[model samples]
Target: MPTQIVNIKDQLFENIFDHAPNGVAIVGLDFRWVKVNQSLMDLLGYSEEEFYAMTFPDITHKDDVAADMELLGQLLNGAINRYQIEKRYFHKTGKVIWGLLSVSFERSPIDGAPLYFISQIVDITRQKEMIGQMNAITNIANIQNEKLKNFAHIATHDIRTHLGNLGVISGFMEEELEVLKNNENFLMLKEALSQLESTIDNLNEVRKSDFSTEERMTSLNLKDFVDSAIYNINAIARHEQCKLINEVDGTFNVMAVAVYLDSVILNLLTNAIKYSSKERQSYVHLRSLESEDYIILEVHDNGMGIDMEVHQAELFQFKKTFHNRADARGIGLFLTKNHVESMGGKITVESRVDVGTTFRVFLRKA
Candidate 1:
């Protein structure tokens, strides 16, 4: 009965070892394979007989052999009891396979002499391939972003020079030909030139936010900032027959890049006023709400609201216009969104056609 029980225990151990999920092997002190499980053979694309005839160094990637041998030497010298390393192996079919290899030294029961090694290999080839793919994609995106920055710099410099020259020429013509100043075609040319200049300015603003490397954030009182924005835009609001109201709490503070916050506020306020409905009493209202990590600034307006179903996808895109307004360059919301996101915040909108629009700007809490 004692002998039978011992045999049963050995069978159970063998079953667990042979059916292990990862590759398992027993290697002789001479680095030759003493025994290998089915998983090890499958992992290296070799039969058990072939693996038994070979040594680990024979299948190891040439570049990895030295490092693996050094670790084994440490284990042999009793410097380390066990070791693990990420190494490559050459499959029988000539492909490289990545593996997480864990190994421990075994000793003879009575003599305490070196016996063999127990090794476990977890295949990590798929994970390694996925990491490589992600790194490649990130590199491509960085290259394209750099190219865009360079293009923006060149376009801003060269185009501004040409626009300056046109402005000078237009001023000269206006001064010398008073009769042509009133001509319909000449008036149209002036308007077009003005619009072009405004567009270039908008492009420069967008470029600044998009490529700004260091964004310095400071704590700002939400109400004070909203008041300042309303003060600056008061003339335009009044001219458009739109009332500007500040409903933000006086004590609410937020963390934001100052220039970016200012731009975001001004853009939302101006757009609200600019697109106000003629059929109603137009008003732009500013308020705030608090979340655990963010302070939300809500700018609601009784304006000519957007058809979100039709224009939601392009709402914040460059030069994308939803309404037919002569002054609509479509840069305001785009720049605002860029500014908000650059500061680690986000902007969202809610609107109903001919009823109202509300822009919610989320900022980090101070």
Candidate 2:
């Protein structure tokens, strides 16, 4: 009895196992559970009796059992002093749990025989989940950054090109003004200057657009915005002799920024007019449909449709246009796509050469 008391004292002092908050366990050299603490039972939702009745292999996750057994063999064979690793375990209720496990060998005083193994298991599920979420967010931010970089390059190049065009025309006007002062042809030169000014204004507006602002959202009536767009572009539509057809439901609403939505709709409407087939009567269809997830708008025109093979990839790129229409500056579709995506929406096109084109806009329902 005295010897047994000394043994218990030595085990308690040398083990230093009981005070740890993580589960502490002891397994015999034969890989069976010899002792387990209160923390271990609590972690696995098992009684002490239930834990003792099973071997370590039975509780370990099946995928981890073989690897853990190999680590145990290294401990038993005196190849390692301690082993630390992350592994999964099967709880009493059959849930898989992640744990950080550290194990060391134990030796008996009698003849220095290998007695058992001591293991400490720290639960790390919450920390692991947090790491996964952080990685996902980081990936999304990287993709957004790449897209923003592309947008900056496009805006710079396009604005610079328009500025260059204005400079060339301004130079011509300077020479013409000196040669033919107040001549009737000067009115044509003045008109060109006015158009250049309009182009510069459009460029500045696009540059100043801040699509990232969360405060820009409000519930907007689709028909009202479309009407506003139509009125804004009345001159251009009238010139093209385009008939505007509206099939939108009166009460359709969407969560969007008012100015950006107005710009998007106006651009689409004008594009439908601009690309209308010269041989046929120009007609544009502004249609809307809705479902639980999205509000769908289609801008359809009987026009000289796009060639998908060569132009599909560049369709939404700045300064890219398949048609050589006189008014095409190539920024409208690019800006439209960005505006749609900025507000948690998407835009796509369906077209074939000479088969007409459909621009589909999908906005989230408010």
Candidate 3:
């Protein structure tokens, strides 16, 4: 009766494990597969015999090996009970497989030594590919925008010089041709000069409205700035059920224009709340990292992610709106990028639709 009960329980476990929705596998301490379910086999395009003979390393991407190995080492050292990472693997046909790998450490029942790894892999290949395409699109747009700025500078300078010359000639005509002062022709010239002056004023406004390539930078306490920004944006976050968190270390500061820093943080935080996911409670997290030469500020959000394939190019274009939100003028990111680059910094974005978005700004450390 004892034997029969044990067999029945094993059968029940097998049934549940086989029909599981996700790919599940167990690898022994020898780095050989001890067990793998059907879903894992289908996901990897390998048969039971093939997978059983292979080790996990045979399928992992080369670039991800060190990180994965490090995590495994931590688990074995008892530094962590489990580790999770979004990593890449090689498919059977030599294609890339992006998987969110969740690994838990197990120990031998007899000797209490490290035994095996239980891995649950969820395929995120599509999400990774979409982000890659979006990055390409954004790069092209940035290049074009740079060209447009150069063109504008040249065009504005030439137009301003021409207008100044026209004004001078009109003044000389009004003084020398006295009788013509009352004539419609003289009046028309006067009107033309007035219009030219107005045009130059408009051009100057445009120049001031965008970031100046030569804006002055100052040392800024990133933590203070972030705190102030969050304080100001709290009501909206509360209304949206969005929590804004600051995890920046207190020791680091950056070389940034103070006014622009305020605007960038506020605008990004607003967008984070504005496009929040309805499926869960939303969050906007701010964190910073320090390197030898750069301070990296990352603004992360769990929001209604962008359809990057369709909207990446126009994401930072002035007046280019992507979402149906009435307040999305599309100028915020444009100005944010302009201000960041103007202060000798760089910005990048990575996102997965319906998952989240992360904006990374790299600036010189002060």
**lDDT (10s digit) by residue, model 3, range 231-311:** 666767888889888998878888877667777787788888998999998899999998788899899998878878888
> In model 1, where do residues sit more than 4 Å from their true spots?
1-5, 141-215, 221-253, 278-281, 287-296, 307-348, 362-366
lDDT of every model, 2 decimals: 0.88, 0.80, 0.82
Q: Whose TM-score is greatest here?
A: 1
Clashing pairs in 3: none
Regions of candidate 2 where Cα sits further than 4 Å from its true position: 1-212
On the 0 to 100 scale, the lDDT of residue 37 in model 1 is 93
TM-score of each: 0.70, 0.45, 0.54
Candidate 3 global TM-score? 0.54
TM-score of candidate 1 against the unseen true structure: 0.70
- What C-alpha lDDT does candidate 2 achieve relative to the native structure? 0.80
**What would the per-residue lDDT of candidate 1 be over residues 1-366, giving only the tens digit for each residue?**
599999999899799789999999999999999999999889999998899889999999889999999999999999999999999999999999999999997898889999999999999999999999999999999999899988998998899899899989989999998898789667766665765576567567667774452445778888877876776666677789998878898989988766677779989988898889999889988889999989999999989999999999999999999987787898889999998988889999999999999999998889
Q: Model 3, poorest ten-residue lDDT window?
A: 207-216
